[model samples]
Target chain A: MKTQTSRRTLLKKGLGSAAAAIFLRAKTARSHNIKRYPNSCGVLVDMTRCIGCRSCEAACNAEQKLPSPALPFDDRSLFAQGRHGSKRRTDENHFTVINRYDPPEIDHPLFRKIQCNHCQEPACLSSCFVNAYTKTPEGAVIYNPDVCVGCRTCMIACPFYIPAFRYSSALHPQIVKCQFCYETRLKNNLLPACVEACPQEALLFGKREKLIKIARHRIRNDRDRYVDHIYGEYEAGGTSWLYLSSVEFDQVGFDTTIPHEPILNSVKNFLAMVPMVLTIWPPLFAGFHLLAARRARAEKTRQENNREKADEDV
Target chain B: MKMFNPENVHLPVSGSKKNDGSPWSFQDKVLLGLTPRQYLSQLCRNRVNWLLVLIFGVGIPLIVQRYFYGLAAVTHGSNDYPWGLFLGFGLFGMVPLSASGFLLGTTVTLFGRKDFHPIERLALLNGLLGYFFAVVYLLVDLGMPWRLAYPMFVSLGPAAVLFLVAWHVATYLSVQIAELLPALFEWLNRPAWKHYIAKISLGLTIAGIILSTLHQGALGALFTYAPTKIHPLWLSTDFQWIHFLCSAVFGGLSMVIISSFLISRYASWRCGKEFSSTLHDITLGLGKGASYAVFTYLVIKIVAIAHDNEWEYLLTAWGGYFLLEIAIGVVIPLILFARGVRRGSVTTVRWAAAIAVIGIIWNRLNVAIYCFNYQLYQEVPHWKEVWLTVTLYALYFIVYRFIVYRLPIVFTWNKQSRKP
Candidate 1:
């Protein structure tokens, strides 16, 4: 009797697991396709044209209404003020920073300005548990302070290390980052403050598709002057802001080791397990409990029946 | 309590009646049948209480300063290293140690391992307090602690890994509380409540197993987002979740062994004969379980390195440090637990459990802080931040002790108390 019951249960368990596998496969197929907007705007930064002028920095401060800098934006001494032998980063007060990186192989120092990359599939948007981050159709990654729980998972998720928290204000702390001037300028189809204020004509703003074409054309036209690679073209699933550099990107403080795929790709394997475990574990373990209890009961009943037969024989 | 023992002085308030056959009141149970003055003296007698007082004395003011002045006042407030000791040592470190609740729950309730019934309540209580305190640590670390509910009610990013973590931890906490309600009911002499919990115990255990498996994995999956930041040797997106879940199995069981060992040694006066007599065998059983888990964990760690082709990293200095962590945290504990269980040496197992507990915390800290941002400079936590972390754990200790003192967690409840 026990052997028959065990065989039936084994069959049931096998069928149940097969059904779960089918369900899981169907669920995962719909989740991996990330949508892309066709008409997103982007910025093309020509690093060779930049002459380390701080006009864009000044313009960003004024446009964003940020606090006045400790040293005037014109002060060249700020270049030497990198803490821990590292470049200055975006913070609560500043939306962007231009760091001076001197390659040993080059005659002149190159200035690399960085802010939010606003990836095609933004890690910040995907990682925010409260929906605090959004990748706008305009190719801007924006944050809603009202909905943010300030868990700082976005900070961890960002490959560019762009988001900055307002650690100073306990009452109204928020994540401060570049939103591509979306509210004040992007919606009006005007150039971002930094791009408009560039004295070098180093910053070019256009449709992301057009910008990519323009970047390729410039690289092809001046093959000796510029590196063959277009930074951010496919990096982290292709950021909105692209860079053209004279030297290797790693020499100019760019993290050359970043994966070409989106950050969400790495986490998908774990997320796929969530639904599978939730659906399968309860029934699986509950079945085990029932089976164990049944076995226990069967053993007790057989012993009792054997003892009664022994007494009858006596 | 030992200092003022008098003949005919009935203590611990185990049953409904006193030594003189008088009924025990609520006050008697709360005070362990001691006078108000005696209770205060007993509290002051314990040296551990003094250390807790000292921690809170400094930590409470620092906590108040953090709230008024912001995170910058307490933490280094590094934009690069957003998480510090608060999260590194609190959330990641504590959560894995708390996995005991579901592991033991499944063993006793689902698998019908009736021998494990003696230590089941202690495991459940350990999990409940560990999780509860982890939330406390999170509240302190969050930028807008008030908006904690926003993820659940105000806004939802259901696709995120953290979304799974948030939902699973919340539900698992409730499930754990329900699973342990029988002990609470037994202590309160509420037979009806206990009986009700008995009906749903199986369901709660299954829920616990499911929730533990996911969230334990989700915590590791959180680090996958920072693949570029963390050192490659420590981060394996393919097996990160499995690494976390498997380690948690030994971490939780080891915690139970450590806790039971401590209870049997230091708090033996409060324990019943059943708990005291069988604790050695139970420790061996738990140690055997932990040894198996640790062995599996060791294999997976090696497999993770091989899968990611990170063997070259072992030749570097960072690789050396990683190897040291595995040696001290995983390998040593594995060997000790294996030998101790085989030999039935409870002392060896106890030492192994202590080391394993620290090893798991070390692994979490390595992932969350030490090995994070491998290219950037390291950020050491502020003194205030470290103090606050200690303060929260001290408070956790006090609450754990408070519950163990009053409830029938380490000891069986007197079933006859309900008859009167």
Candidate 2:
């Protein structure tokens, strides 16, 4: 039994060393690649130029072929009561909704269109377990309904609350969100319907890098007309949709306080610990068990030896 | 039922019957020593049954209404507050409370603490039921509950934190069931099955530890995806997972302590002498462990706040609420647990455990629902949503009571010891 136990320990040690070597090699290879998406397409929304016409909303609805709203797109009353002190948001039926925010100091109400910001490193994409969501090089955060399990974790995980579930359906429920016109417009390298329909030319479409240059140029060229900072330039590790506002971005319905780093980076701290615990805990705990068992074995042996001595004396 | 010799019939006091040489039927096993009439009488006599029946009566219809009419039918249908009580109470509240199984398993099996062995099965049972019901709550809340297997067999989201949570929870649930199988085998007079399970016990325990660690931390990591939304006081990029994991250690232990107290007080008939006698000692031991965990949690929480330099937020109302959660959930429970352990006062410890359990639930709810998007107006859950949450919890209670009444969780099956 002792020989067998020793042999097993030796084998485990050999396997452990081999695994360590392989893991180290893999870590080095992973560090070497460090890939980043460079040529992604993006949109820049200039809030100063947008009129609360709801034209973008109408265009998005028509383009997506979504169900008609209970209120007509022309109904201005819908903008009277905004959502949670912001503006209207994306839902299962509506991929994009324009919201009106009236700043106390400003004479005119500002319109900010809400949809999937199409984040460069989207939380929804990272939070999906089934690989259901994809951030295409065309700069659209698209979802595959076929793989979604209705876990709603993505809904919980999304900072913008962009992903909406078709909860009413009993048989074939799926997540509904804006795909940035990936199928009809983005695939053909054409501007999204929302951008095309905006009569004020409030929305601009181009490569993300080029869009950043245009946004900066607008801000630098006419300093008083636009906010100094681009809304999506650093928020949540930048997004495909950039925003330039006349008033403070927060005043115009943008979440200005979101961290610059990708949200997944926060979670990775915990994830990195998982494999370490799995590898280290078993052997460590098992070793403790062996040590405890050894003491029991030694005690039993001593008792047996003493009993034999006592029997001989008798 | 077939008369195994009285000496060989290793049944609890209520489990035995005067068998007249026939195989025991499922009904006979369920009835145990009670006559069919007596069992029926007991079932009808319980007041809890009427409450459950009423909940199902009302809630089932509402659930159906939800499906037919849409989330708008049963809920206020606020797009702003997408998640309501179903998630707040069920998923967030239950998962932490269920942490007892892995914690206790580590103590008894890995650490060789034989004194805790008597109550180990109860802890396992508590963990299993909590997780099972959490999933049940998930089903009720999910738009397409039937497609739950999509993440596993159909779609793969390897990058998602929730993906890890779903896979790990499913895997851990299986692991927990496997861990509890030995008790079931023992009760069924299957010594061979018991031996086989015992042989693989170490492997299962390690797996439970690993799976529990990831999923429990994953639950917290799920919140990391909403970094800006969750209040900074509760949100810690570096310490969020650790905070969740540490809290669960005590949260699970406290749940076991609370459950044991309830069993000893209300259902003593179901528990054998071995369980009842050793329970108080185990409770104290568990309290000691809980105190240590709570202390660590408190320190890490402070470190998290300090790390982020969020000291100024303490002056705000949100900060006050955060401090209140810490005070009630961490400080008060820690003090109570410590005092109870020092005084060897089982009653005091039990009360502390109950408080800790409630405190843990409150903290989780605060993180998931209340403190979430703190800058925005607070979302009050819809009436139907609240009702649905209560209905699910009632179901959990019924299942727990049913299992405790029959399973050899608190009591050992006498037949196994009688054998060679």
Candidate 3:
């Protein structure tokens, strides 16, 4: 009876292990198709064309229905200081901001438009466990405040430092960022408010492929006027918003050192180890348990044999 | 306190019980076996109560002020540094220190190191409370603390590293609770539940290992999202997770050592002879593990720098700070651990463990706050932020003390069975 029970247990264990292995393989296969949207919409901002106008900023504020800024949109003194400090950022009150960079080499100041770059593979979307973020087909990275836990992880995960939290709100809070106007405008095939409001036509909205081509064309045609490279063509795995600047990208506050690969790629190394640990740890630990139990098992068997011998003798 | 000690010297099993043998009531237990009047007298006699009163007198109102007015009332309100001391110390620092659950679980259940069984329950309790309070810290820092569950059931961002961390940490918290159920069962005198947990112990342990591996690595991976912002010396695309995991091994083990020492010193009344006797040996064994982990961590740190070819940054001021962190946090504690292990000095090992714990905190803080946005100006945490962090940690301490006082963590159960 004991032998029969042991045999049954061994068979069960064998079947369970086989089933787990099969499940693991199937899960790995399914994970490959989980890439972000490939044909998402994008924007290209040519810094050479920007004349330090804050019109885009005002348009974003009005479109989002955010509270009006302390400084009026016509106040050019905000640029003369050339430093917005903590005020110059995407916040609960503002989804985008334009910062002026005065480089020693350039005669005129350069204006850099700051907003969510909306990477082809967004870290914010991936980092959200509740799935509050989505990358639409139009390439606009959007967020749902309803599902937001206000964990502020998107703020941490954003490679472009775009997502801002409303920390002061004790009752209701949400992350603020440029969503490319996905709900109100982009979904209806209308351009984002900021892109439409640019009087100088500094911002171009279209398919990411076309935007890249357009940005490259402008740079190639006016090499002396524009920088040799198109920013965000590959940065952080190809952001939707491309940039062409007269000065170097870094000089205009662009983080040029960001890798071409998506930020998610860096985390993949660890994620790959998750399934391995889950699969390997059980059997490996169980084997150790069996080994550790060996001595105790042998001792129990010896005691049983002695008791049986004594009973026979009596 | 007369009820705490029986005048009669007989009945060894009921050494501290009254002659007419009855279990102490919950209220009586709280009073430490003293009468109501005596309990009040004892409370009044202790000078520590006055200090606690003074602290609460000032601190509680400040905490209330935070809730009524908003975070801006207390914090510097700098958007440039969204995360302050609450996250830097409470989240990043506390989580790694709390890795003791997975470490001890892997030790006894996975590696079959039953020799270290005496203090296993304490280590598990330490882990559970650390994580529980880490979440509490997270809640206090979150803008919408009430909507904390929105990310789990409502929204699903499977692609994000933070999403993975949230899911895994939540799942792992449940796993750790389940892993700890055996101790709870033992305390509750429910042997059947203990048996049930033991049956599925292997599965629970494997789950713990998997979740811990991902989340600990994910915390480091979270920083990888800000490649240009974080200091180049700390950011290694290929080895960031490994660096985190390796350091956490030492961090968790060292935490266990420190906790064990504190319990042994302050709560000897609560500890059993077996725990007290075996704790020193376990400390040595844990120190050995910490040494091995720190040695590997040092190697990985070197390899990460080399792999990134960030040797040129070594001449910069940030590089000097990195070196300082390594020297003070890693190298010094490692030397202390080695010497303590060789000499069989429990005191030395205990102090080394404390230093190692601090070192781990320093390392995590460096990654999360100090060296982050290297090109940007340094962000000093707001004074209110600092106070709030301290208050939250003090609450963690209180909870820890409460559990340790009541649970069978430090003390052994069923001592009568061992009697010949």
Question: For residues A116-178, what per-residue lDDT tens digits would candidate 2 score against the true structure?
Answer: 898878888887888888888777889887767766667766777788877666666678888
Candidate 2: segments with Cα more than 4 A from true spot: A1-38, A83-86, A298-314, B1-25, B67-70, B416-420
Q: Report the CA-based lDDT of candidate 1 relative to the real structure.
A: 0.90
TM-score of chain B of each: 0.97, 0.93, 0.92
Q: Which candidate has the highest lDDT of all?
A: 1
The order of the candidates by DockQ, greatest first, is 1, 2, 3
For model 2 chain B, the run of ten residues with the poorest summed lDDT: B1-10
lDDT of 3 by residue, A1-314 (tens): 44555878899999999999999999987664335555778888988889877999999999999899889998888765422243266677878888888889989888889999888888788767678787778888888887777766667767787888776776666787888888899999899999999999999998888887887787778789987888988887878898988888878888788878777777777667767776886677678768767866787899999999999999
Could you tell me every candidate's TM-score relative to the true structure?
0.95, 0.90, 0.88
Q: Which digits, one per residue and each the tens of the lDDT, describe model 1 over residues B128-208? A: 999989889999999999998888999999999888888888999899899888877777777677788888888888889
lDDT of 3 by residue, B74-190 (tens): 776556667777777887888888888888888887666887888788878878888888788887777777777766776566656776777788888898898888666655556
Interface RMSDs of the predictions, in order, are: 0.7, 2.2, 2.5
The C-alpha local distance difference test score for the whole of candidate 3 amounts to 0.78
**Per-residue accuracy of model 1 over A1-314 as CA lDDT, tens digit each:** 44555878999999999999999998876556556678889999999999888888899999999999999998988988877778899999888898998899889999999888889999999999999888888888898999998899999999999999999888888999999999999999899999999999999998888999999999999998899989998898899999999999999999989898889999988988888998998888888999999999999999999999999999
- Name the candidate that leads on DockQ: 1
The candidate that achieves the highest TM-score relative to the unseen native structure: 1
